[model samples]
Structures are given as structure tokens and as C-alpha cells.
Target: MTKTAIIAGTGVLPGILADRLDETNTPYVIAELEGFAMENPKGRPVERFIVERLALLFDRFDDLGVEQVIFAGAVSRPAIDPERIDPKTATLLPVLLPAFQQGDDALLRAVIALFEDAGFSVVGVDSVAPELVPGEGVLTTAQPSQDDKADADRAAKVVAGIGALDVGQGAVVAQGLCLAIETLPGTAAMLRWVAEVAKTCRANPNGAKGVFFKAPKPGQERRIDLPAIGPDTVVQADAADLAGIVIEAGGVMLLDPEATIAEANSRGLFIWARTP
Candidate 1:
């Protein structure tokens, strides 16, 4: 039997994955991380562990017979406490600690390498739920207008530029202006900020809503950590007065397609998926 485990962090992504696994009767363990800085997790039978005790976490997983792992949800980078590291992980700290200075994509790759070196299969969330990958094209009744399409195109280029530097994967372009770029707080926060800006311009005679673009970082390992767009994501974008969302088709995951599309349509918003 293939034993799967979820190295979950904070966010709805963990819960989404958990629900899918449960619906399919897939047995799994949740290796929950400590802290609320990045994500508030939702799952059952979770074994909480700090990054410092990674080796101990492996021991617990081994006891549970967890052979394969999925890194789910967003985990922000924090200053790791070397003193908290178990003696086992400390032995490998020389190989691991350097990742702290690298960008998120590089750090994620290092983490994946750690798991693989342990004889565990590190898989992407899409590997377990391939249906979540969005298809290329407009996914809603209201497609983007020419202006919105232009903004999306600009946003895509901006996101790609930042991505190449391992900066971020999302950007908001409105009224021919780049409103905001996603930062460590993540995409939702960026949308929220954009929403605030849209409110300020609500009375502007020439004001127009915007579009949020998400794509993979340049040269980013796509097997895991691809950008995710879900129902909550649509709601955030809508709140930002974004006309629609532009995602990299085949590069992003739509966690709740039915609900997300329904919500987008209801809000008079659109979800367009384009290829990179």
C-alpha cells in the first residue's frame, strides 16, 4: 500500500487537500508545523513539529509508515533556531542551513531534496488531485475586455520579471498601473491591499477595476509550489474590484473550481487562464 503524508502548513490549501484525500479514502498523516506566522492549518490527527526538529519528525513519520509526502499550504520563511535543532538534523545542518539565504523557490527545492534524500517521494499537490489544474481559456461567462486583457498581459510580464529574481508570483494591474505585487504575506494580502486602493479610486471618473495575475517563478520547480487560485482567491480578487483573474494555464491550481467559478460569475468577475 502506498502510504502518503501531508507536510502541511498554514492555509486553506491543507484543508482542501485533506478533503480531497478523505473523499477518495486515501489514508494520510498530517505533519503539521508549529506557529501561526504563515498558516493556520486544518486537518486531523496532526503531529505538530518545529522545523528545528525535522529529524524527529521523520522518526514520527517512519513510525506511521509515511512513505510519500506532499508539501501543502504556504509556510513563510522564519529565522530558524539552531538550538532547537535535534542532534540528528544538526548533523545535516551544514547542508540545510544555507537554504535560509536563498529565495523561496530555492529553499523549497532544498526542502524537497531533503525529503528525497531520506528515501521519501516528495510529490506535488497536483499529483494527488490533478483535476484541480485549470485548463487554458476563459473559465467564466464574462471574459476579459480589451483593457482588462491589456492589464493582464502587463501583469503577466511583471510577475514573470519578479519571478525570475525569485521575488513573487502575482501582480495586480489596474488602469494601466501596477497597483501591487505579491510579497511574503502572499497573494491574498496583495489583493486585500489592492482592494483598499480600489476603494480610494471608487469616485475617480476614470477609475477602473483590475486583474490579478499568477504564474510560476522563472525556472521554478513546477513539481511542487505552483501558484494556487481558489474560491477564496476569487473572493479576494473580487473584493479588490478586480475585473477578473489571469492565471498561467497548466501552471496554477484551482482548488474549488465549481464554487470558484460560481462565485466569480455571481460577482460579475471572470477567471481567465492563459498559457505562459
Candidate 2:
């Protein structure tokens, strides 16, 4: 059996993945980032690593017989300390530094390449937990009005436009008017900003507030960093006074699908796993 190394960041996802791996008796180890700690480690075997010394992590993985790697949860860019950069990581700085100047997609692709070059296969979350990616449909009891559907369509295009520049994975559109685009601050912060804005603005003529749409960037490396939402997202959207939440079916991960749907239903907000 190939042992897998899960590079966990901050969020419930790493714990959720750990739980699934446990249920199947799969051999795995959780490698926690230095600053971005896993929300719930579930008492699994864990190792800590810093980005500046990845060579040491590779060596540790070798000792643990880890042949595959997967990334779970969210991570902010770490400020590198030049003094801590190991000789091996230093050799890759030329590539990495330039990627760091680029968008997140570029940086992640570069990171993935390093692991691949070290002879490990990188896997996507969907491959390990297909159920987390909900299929196309309105998941909540509340349905999207025709206006909401149109807003979703517009939001999808806006997300794609920003994604092409490696900007973000989410957007808010109401009655074909672009309300906001998510940037590095992330979905929760973006939604909070939208809520603040809603306090002063009137609803669209059609009476639909807006749609919060999320999806992975076009041409993004889906093996890691896919857009995700959970119960909290539902609460945030409701607070923003949005009509519904729209996620690209098969692209966005639904953390705790049951709770997310339940929250949306209770808030009378629709959760549409849209097809595209």
C-alpha cells in the first residue's frame, strides 16, 4: 500500500479527509504547515514542516514511506526567512520567486512540480472524496427564481474573467449587475463586505438581491486549492442578503454537505450546484 502524505492547512477539510482515510484503514500521515495549523487533526500521526525547508520534509516523507501527496484546506503565503532556506530549497528559489510574483495558480503549480520531481504523485481531493463535490441541482429546499438563475450565469462569467488573471474563484451578481469579486481576502471576507454594502443599497428591480457564485479558476490545477463552502458559507450568504449560493457543480467542494444544505434551507437561501 502506498502511504500518502496530506499537507494540511487551516480548515475542517484536512480533518474531514483524515476521517475518511481512517474509515477505509488507509495508511496516511498529516503534514501540518508551520503557521497554518489543521483545525482538527483527529489525533492522527502528524509532522510539522516549514516552507523554507521543504527538503527536510521530502526526507521525512521518505522515512515514512509516503509515495503520494495531497493538499487540503486553505493557506496564506508565508513570509520566507532567508536564513532558514535550506540548500535544496535555495536552489529552487529562482523558479519559486518568480512564481510567487505571479498569481496563486502559478505558485501552486510550481509547488506541485517540486513534489512531482521528488517522485511523488499528487492527487486531487475529488479523487479521494468524490461525494464532497455535489452534483448539479438545487440542493436546498428553496429554489432559485428566474432572476437568481440569471444572476448566477452572470456571476459565473465574472468569476471566469477574474480567474483568467488568477484573481479569485467567487463573484456576486444581482440582476446582471456585478456587485463584488473575491480577491485574496477570501470568500468570507468578501461576503462580509457585500453585507456591508447591502445595508445602503436597494434591491434590484426584480426584487432579487444577488447570487454568491463560486468555482475553480479556468485552467487551474484542481489537485489543490479548489473553492469550497460549508455551513458557514450559508450563514454568510444569508447575512449578505443574497438570494442564493451558486457553485460550479463538480468543481467546488461542499464541506459537510448535510449541514450546508440544512443551513441554506433554514435561511431560505438556495444552494445551486450549477452545471456550468
How close is every model to the real structure, measured as TM-score? 0.89, 0.96
* Tens digits of per-residue lDDT for model 1, 113-208: 888888789888787888788778999998999988888889989998899888899998886778889877889888888777644553343656
Which residue runs of candidate 1 sit more than 4 Å off their true CA positions?
A: 36-43, 198-208
Off by over 4 Å in 2: 202-206
* C-alpha RMSD between model 1 and the true structure: 2.8
Q: State the lDDT of candidate 2 residue by residue for 53-166, as single tens digits.
A: 998899899998999999998898898899999998888788777887878999999999999988899999987788999988989899999988998999999999999998
- Candidate with top lDDT is 2
| Backbone clash tally (model 1) | 1
| Candidate 1, residue 124: how far the Cα is off, in Å | 0.6
For model 2, how big is the CA root-mean-square deviation? 1.5
Q: How close is candidate 1 to the true structure, as a TM-score?
A: 0.89
Best by TM-score: 2
What local distance difference test score does each model get? 0.82, 0.89
